[model samples]
Target chain A: MYLLRRGDPTMFETFWRGPIGESATLVIPGYQTMSYFSDVGNLCWFLEPGFEREVRRLHSLVGNAAVEGYHVLVGTGSSQLFQAALYALALPTANAPVSVVSTTPFYSMYPPLTDFLNSGLYRWAGDANAFDGDDYIEVICSPNNPDGSIREAVLKSKSGKDIHDLAYYWPQYTPITHMLAHDIMLFTVSKCTGHAGTRIGWALVKDKEVAQKMSKFMEQSTIGVSKDAQLRAAKVLGAVTDGYEHQLAAAAGGDANLLFHYARRKMAHRWCALRAAVAASGIFSLPNEVAGFCTFTKDTVTSNPAFAWLRCEKQEVEDLESFLRENKIITRSGTKFGADQKVVRISMVDTDEAFGIFVNRLATIK
Target chain B: MYLLRRGDPTMFETFWRGPIGESATLVIPGYQTMSYFSDVGNLCWFLEPGFEREVRRLHSLVGNAAVEGYHVLVGTGSSQLFQAALYALALPTANAPVSVVSTTPFYSMYPPLTDFLNSGLYRWAGDANAFDGDDYIEVICSPNNPDGSIREAVLKSKSGKDIHDLAYYWPQYTPITHMLAHDIMLFTVSKCTGHAGTRIGWALVKDKEVAQKMSKFMEQSTIGVSKDAQLRAAKVLGAVTDGYEHQLAAAAGGDANLLFHYARRKMAHRWCALRAAVAASGIFSLPNEVAGFCTFTKDTVTSNPAFAWLRCEKQEVEDLESFLRENKIITRSGTKFGADQKVVRISMVDTDEAFGIFVNRLATIK
Candidate 1:
């Protein structure tokens, strides 16, 4: 039923719905790679140095984050990296399981992923403000997943290790206001290039041991990320950087920053349409957002986020997801995001047609 | 150095040296699938019933394993499946760590992977033969990684669960003497279709809860296997099965069993050459393998095996890998596989060019 309603304006697939086929499609050589090992900088499997070079080059150009003095470790996706970051930060050699915390309305994966292995190395201790702890892993999902809230580590523990998931910190998703130079920072092609199907993500780590351990975890798990995927990622990332140089003169009005500009405009347009829909419905409320000065754009820029965090306004109405589903609109319940049941998250990245249908249905939900 | 030696005659690189061009390549349709959460027959990610149908159909045509009364879960590779199997079999909820054991000269990954996370749920309990416990996971790697020996459960405890890794049970690597209907069976696209780089593998699991737990493990680790890879694997697997029906009748002398025939002959020829080389070396002893009744070929067929386990007969050649390295031939040491240092694993799957050089080097070693 879910598959049948894939684009029913009901399922808000937050992952990606971008250009594929020839543009993103990969035709791996018949005699292509198969080894879980690579000559990719003396690490574990699947990574090739050529591919890593391209990744490092892209980050350097984007200026969204610093890659220097960091071990570049790849994951099946940032979701895996999120788990790796926790695993690396919480040393088994430690006396007790490190407490993992984020502020309220955190990325849903954090708490569940932390406790999934049932491993005693780390425990999801809940809201950062409520938890009193020195040894903890503070996961900062800047330009956050569910609600599109930009945030800093709420916990002020000196002993806390911060894992900055910069998945949405790209110029297209959010303002590249600052160059992140955190201990452990994660970025993914899924959000940046909208190639979620590729399942390629990487982390830049300042600590050598933590980086090695993260890589070790990947090795024991999937051996490494897929080589075919890596090759595709390298190309896609190259194209993004190429867009920065306006390499495709025929596209984007010959603008140097084609990808970022196009994505930014598209996101902003979607946000406009979504806001108008919510306003017409008069049954939902949304939080206000502010833009930041972007280094890449050299201007104060704002982003219409990839998600619309919808909250029911009426006191009698709760179970926002169920409420929205009744109107043929699908959304993730706010409870999943550690918020109230009266709130739900509607994705802003679905196809234009689906988005139109969603806006129409949402407006009619009186 | 490893990348440079990719096509080196010393490296077998036999995993894949086949023709790869547009035909085998995949072009996922523009606006193709994304969303880590799939409606792929529930349970977990990367597994769509459409893809699972192809997998089961392939297995059925190959006469390799039983898929009935099983839950299909995909992973990054059989390596991940192996870890998942261990994790699923050893429930952390059981109040105590389950002893994970494999027989002597087991696949090198068993011990390290078992202990990687340092998870208290399971411990690497050395050799299976040495461990006497009911609650244990005994891994049986048929046509095992290091040495191509076919095997079964070394421990027969009532409370024990066995994970059968049939990675090399295909007719090309080993004779398909029987259809595996084990509790947990691990199979990979790498050895099967020589597409190891795709990082796709599946476990045919009999028990429902065990399969669900394994799916959960994959979910928390990589979220799921690469969907692109899964689609490609489905197509590649379909091609293999298509060859089984002689779908491309114009090729292979109208034989439906073209792939098997070609692969079998290639493996047999390689083995014949390998035998001659070892005989000429006069410093090594090779194990003798007999043919088994194969249902596919309808004959008592033998295998060339994917790996050559060579034992140094000379007293001076204690470190066989070092000795082979001195001769510009790279081989994995036997101690890595829990065997004597004098024994080393030589990959028999390298291309014809590399195999020839390896044969020449071994023949001249004395």
Candidate 2:
């Protein structure tokens, strides 16, 4: 059952509504994490050591990202970290603001978030593929948000900087191809453990100066992130890692009590249902399915993204989001992601009931 | 015993160290508050209803701020809310950035926080008293940060916007004279309940449009405040209010298990000790003590601010902070707060041990 409160029925749902059980849950005592400083000796003083340890352990367990020798700085979320990365990368002494670019069909928030302050430090420069600027910050979102495609940095300018948004790079969202060793990479518990409300994200920075600047930006922006959230995230991430460890000890039990396994299965099931719905509708199409050899799961797996990039084939559907809205469904417009109006991005991680309702509505659209 | 982590020895101390026992302790279950949305029906979509309810109740019980008609918007902290208020008040179409001015000897962070982004929407414009422009934003921190003096808006320009930072306005810091009905007033659990690590603050805004804009800024900046932190804040605030209610029923028993009463008594004792230390030092002077009749306490009370603004009377001590640093005590330089070099702001809310050490050091400074 969907435990939804009465409000905007059309509002997009988040992933954690499904039953993943109590292992990922956390209990924080009132007196815990009351001080602003978590580890005063660390460069990112606000970061809880336990959260950092869990983040490293999770990445190590999943074989997704390299954390060793990298500075771990916590943020409110990947959103704040994205801005912090921009702030850190931008040359303050420069005469003009640094241009920040991403590939088309980027996360809908990138543009507004970049340009919101009209900050002299950085400004949104659309489409990394079209940008020829030598000094620019390119965001590379792998297993990308809207399209769910594996990506690499498109801009190879010598003076260009890159901020790898690995928010969806976990084994559940995509294949664990290799240990990513980027200069700067962002991850969040929202996608990893479905704790979006925790507002916790961390960056693995290869450069100390950049990490310090990012930390400074956080200090200036919010006087650092919430320690309570960080503590909760630590507990949640620790539980997820523990589940994987338990699974490893019982390797023969294929779908044992593992968060990633459960999440991956759910995603796969959702994708199957969505594809079947679209085929039945005959008026909608989705991005081509991608699969790869898994390193962590030890089996070939089809990619199951957190979002379904759907394109309406009907010429009458001028605005897919509006058309869907008329049919008692809500979707983010492709135009928001710098794509054609005929396409809309549907979140695949919502509650099971919401997903079922969405698929049923889509199947009957014809 | 002080839990001093090995790090920067000169770093200033935070307040929550004294043993207040488990009354304010919160235990949050793991599965609770994982979504980004809290109260979708409210204008501030991310605000948890329980948090809002507790905030209103606390304000009503304390008679500090008028919250009846005001919109209570949650932020990562008052730091973020301060920026949000600035973002909300700044005119997008204005030819130049909105000038943000605080009085001389203001909070050390105000200037840097205001200008860090180099936002075209707002710029740090030194002291409000020196600012002659009609189009500006003025920040009023009552029972002010450095000097702990009761303050009013230094600039009364007809077009100027005011953001009342009432972070130190609680009964412990100062006497609650009346219910303050400001356009934008910011408060935080960091000061109110000694939960600096939670990074949770709420802004009581009178204007709907301004509140919405501030909320939008938060949405763009951090996506939203952490629900876990909000939940904890709600619990802490509720407990504080419960203590007051309990106190009223047991009025004959003074300082009876009330957080505010406990904090007030602690503050009173610390201030007395500090004053005695300064007098004994002969080379140091502190701001004049202020007192008023408190509506909540039902008695005349002296202001026991969170900070002791101390000035060095010794001619050799050009920099008071440096002088204190040599004495193995850390204090914020008055220069950072736009005051004279001889004046330094020392945090009075640190652990009893740290405060005791500080006072002893101060007394022997001569």
Candidate 3:
């Protein structure tokens, strides 16, 4: 019998196949324990009653009343939610041409995701100011990726609809009050909790109709989110809230200034280290280092150019990528981020040891 | 500030809002130790070198070939793979009228999923026998759900493009050797490994062009499957393969005869009990007692209604569902499975004690 190519079997028929008495089991024991339920992990839609109650209780700890009525839709991560939201809004309508707009040099995934969804149908329209409110949807990622720049826009949809994407409104980088109180907000646990593997995020939407439609689309697309991931996220969130409460109470009662003082001093030290490192690495340049990431350009002094703008030559970016792989360190070239070459992004979120190694590598590159 | 309607948030803009930090933190601890890689759990397109090696090893045990050159794609589940397949194949073309054909009472998810994809241009053609090769894609699920039936025609795509969806070719089931030789197959760990919560599934396609296009679609659709979920699946599959080897070794060493005899006796005893219970309960009539499920109909004897044939003008099935629920017995209504209202599916895989309880409850139904 000839062996078939991989991924060719029918799914609907395969699911009911009797337990293959094969020696190999396909899932880990812990995962197996939680696989039966629908909402146990970070990729969940339903919140435990207790978890929901606690979240409401801590509402005052974050932003203001602009968030009212906007409930959270958790996903595998914000990435999943981001793509889902884009698909939901891009449903074809004859009255207007559907377009996606975002700030230039925005999150790298946006254009690819848009292209993937749009295929050849719709195109990305950069610049929030250019939207005519007749045929476009705008995406705004604040405390943005790469540069960590936030753009405040009074965005309106083609049909005079107002939409907002407040993905990075966290207390760590900026004051909580600075959050854009728009109709929708997206956030992820990976960034705040430093649990990138969890792959969990949420969309806070104020409109019931849009939420229902999105839910339907999700159900039709990926079914509901993973139950196990959601439960785990809920448990983690509960623990953090408890920690925050304990810290706040201690501060209020004057029992310990150590907790707050240590946090402040640690932030100061990290910032100072980053500043000094940038200065020492003559090949790097950055506008500021206030947020999670810093964007840098090649200093032009090095014999090896930082980036080769490839769009003009009409060659794929992979050839340049091969050149970078020869070097020990890895950097995301500008093409992936939908930018012209002559620019590259470097992330400073690594651990002190790892960050030190990266800085050292950069220093030697020149 | 005015509160926006519940659903009208900016589609792509919601990611900026910080997640409910405390809630997310509560759920992270449970899955930290778990591996998230497995072909059956999610798509395998993003497998790392180490995990890829392991997956290949497991596939070799099953007598399947390694996935290379072709783009391996992952989905939220095998269900998503099914949707994606339909999307790719049903996209409009000049000669093709964009039609989908499936056997009657097919995998219940097909109709809903197809509609949900809403390629307004494509429509479902229910009769496979009359399917014209020109503009239609036929979906065939083997070891089919509801009725564990396999089809021969599904081995070849109607248009000769290639048969897709190979979910149930494991060792325990009657393998369709011809189908595996060339058709596209989709498989998931949900059934095989009982890890449904991870929501991972893979599709195998013989054609490289189809594979590449699907990969691009996946990247656009959900970026990629959850990395954490994929890793866990990989670990679990390794253990399962080991278990299969041990079982085979025991069988060969003449140490498993006693265990096999015990299992045979146990199955015989359960069937006997089930037969006795059915004789005692006149309200239901079963199609056959041998299959994975005992299908019931409301019309069995004169003046005795087999639950499968019992009809209500509006919502009598729901009434029956409530009646069963009051007994603390849970069984899916046929309506949910794309069957007639008079039919209800009763899984025979429950423990003998649970079956006894179910029998006792049925005795009380009349």
Candidate 4:
């Protein structure tokens, strides 16, 4: 069993622990909240007007990305959109399964989700840089998950299409260096607003036809995301964006900044604390921190990533996961992210108490 | 364009309409609802204790199905479960695309959803009975959508698996015929509680492995259904089951009867009114209504189908949908439901005002 299950609140709590109140929580009436679908667009079933408005509003408020000339498609979460991206990129008419690759030490779910059902449309061909392919789809997870490293499309080729998973690109997760303009970029409410329970995410697609196809895949797959969840997500986004638009924080009346500023502060604190704990542990190592000028935050800032990628230098800890498990520090094996056994990923987003316990345990590692 | 959108409330509005209140509405506490996943069982992310309890309670109270030995898997909606079923049923090792066949005049979305991605894992092979194949999957939509016909597995093959889409099998839509003990049976809150906006559905599977695979399909598909919607669904279901268990109607103490009884009365009235209008027209024909002794209601009950399947006898109507469109009586084209153009399906459960308009227009069909 994964070591995370031993805690009272557990390691999963580390992720998405920000405060959300009445402004974020939505109560849908028992009666019809809205029509099952959008009437004006080709999008089928329940693109709640409030949801669309708030999503567009949030993007504009952050100024981290551009929405114009793009088709915004909502999904169950970024995970489904990732699948939809694969479906949209894969040529249905092709005779052979399209090759799919990501960088080494990449996110693990990509390989399995890409190949599940052994669907003949796409196959997971590992290591984007190592592959000698003219025809393929490359996935680039920016401000990477296990490690807080910014990335760009690694396999630059004419025959390849890129799916940029900007899940970690929000100001809190990483420095929003510039407006992310890509063919397909994915964002999720779970990470940005800390409402993972809502299970809402969206893709900003440059090509309208590709966006339509991706939405069609959602229609065929789940008949679109839940209306209740969408409305709730809309409220959450609105709450965050309201801070910027209405300048709720500038009035200096509240204990917390707007959701964005609040997240930025909390993440910075945790990242700093985590770095100290690792520094205190001479046996462990983390990547050197880097910062970029974030247009949204208007400062040069480093990422406060969701997971801490740690590499063990000692031979006594051959498998970092086993070593962490023995120490009661829950973690995911680094190889799960396509790296070696010397490395493991630990959740830093856990409850502050849990993270303290995690850091204390790390500090004691002699 | 489809004819259904012409009505005041529209055709899509017919599916879910009920008087639900704050008791049924869910306010998801922003605190950790559960870990992003469950630590135990094959089910990964969510198994809301309330969701599973309420699902089984509702099913048992209605006496339409058995969940005693089944694994109840929740989904975003039955439409999503439909795709998951396709994924779980298709042989990953098979050399050829697994043929997925359903009866003619079937639910329209079946064929389109099956072929939407044009995935090589499964291909839509029309008409179950006509296709003589040992290697295929047959979908039996008991009290089928669009046409509202009660059906069974048309093709009995040792090599073929059956997916019983019982979306329309609720006491409101049809009689509680028997303990529907199918291997894989699907039910939805959209039909049962008239909350299509919630987008919650569950599958009761006899085989644990198949259930696990279906759940995995959900995990990889949408990363599980929305937790907020699931909690709300549990509340809706709990309310209905409470009415049934307490025998709300016997005491005459509640505002509404058990959801089943309330739906039964409303649907029967609409179906009777619809038949009278069709009879008055003299240019349209409808399938005869069949009744059976319902164990749950303990009476000989007739079907009050969610839709009215109409066949145009007059030669003037080359395409029945166009004729209806001209009359402002909205309907789905028969060809769209995998049938001939002469037939059309009308939503019987449209709003009182809209259904009245539909019946009035039908009376003038000559």
Best by TM-score: 2
Worst 10 residues of 3 chain A by lDDT: A297-306
TM-score for the A-chain in each candidate structure: 0.90, 0.93, 0.69, 0.92
Weakest lDDT window of 10 consecutive positions for candidate 2 chain B:
B4-13
**Which has the higher DockQ value, candidate number 1 or candidate number 2?**
2
**C-alpha lDDT (0 to 100) for residue A59 of candidate 3:** 42
Q: Which stretches of candidate 4 lie over 4 Å from their true place?
A: A1-20, A38-45, A244-250, A253-255, A316-318, B1-20, B32-35, B38-44, B245-250, B253-255, B315-318, B326-330
Please compute DockQ, using alpha carbons, for every candidate against the native two-chain complex.
0.42, 0.55, 0.15, 0.45
Query: Higher lDDT: candidate 2 or 3?
Result: 2
Off by over 4 Å in 3: A1-68, A87-97, A119-125, A157-163, A235-285, A288-342, A350-366, B1-45, B48-74, B84-98, B119-127, B154-159, B162-182, B204-216, B231-366
Q: Write the per-residue lDDT of candidate 2 for residues A193-221, one digit (tens) a residue.
A: 77788899999999999999999999899
Q: What local distance difference test score does each model get?
A: 0.74, 0.84, 0.47, 0.76
lDDT of 1 by residue, B188-243 (tens): 88777667677888889898888888998887777677777777777667666666
**What is the Cα-based lDDT of residue A33 in candidate 4?**
44
Candidate of highest DockQ? 2
How far residue A310's Cα lies from its native spot in candidate 2, in Å, is 0.7
Can you write out model 1's per-residue Cα lDDT over A237-299, one digit (the tens) per residue?
775665565544544453334567667777787788778888998988887876888888788
What's the CA RMSD of model 3 in angstroms? 12.7
Model 4 lDDT tens row, B102-133: 89888888888888666667889998868987
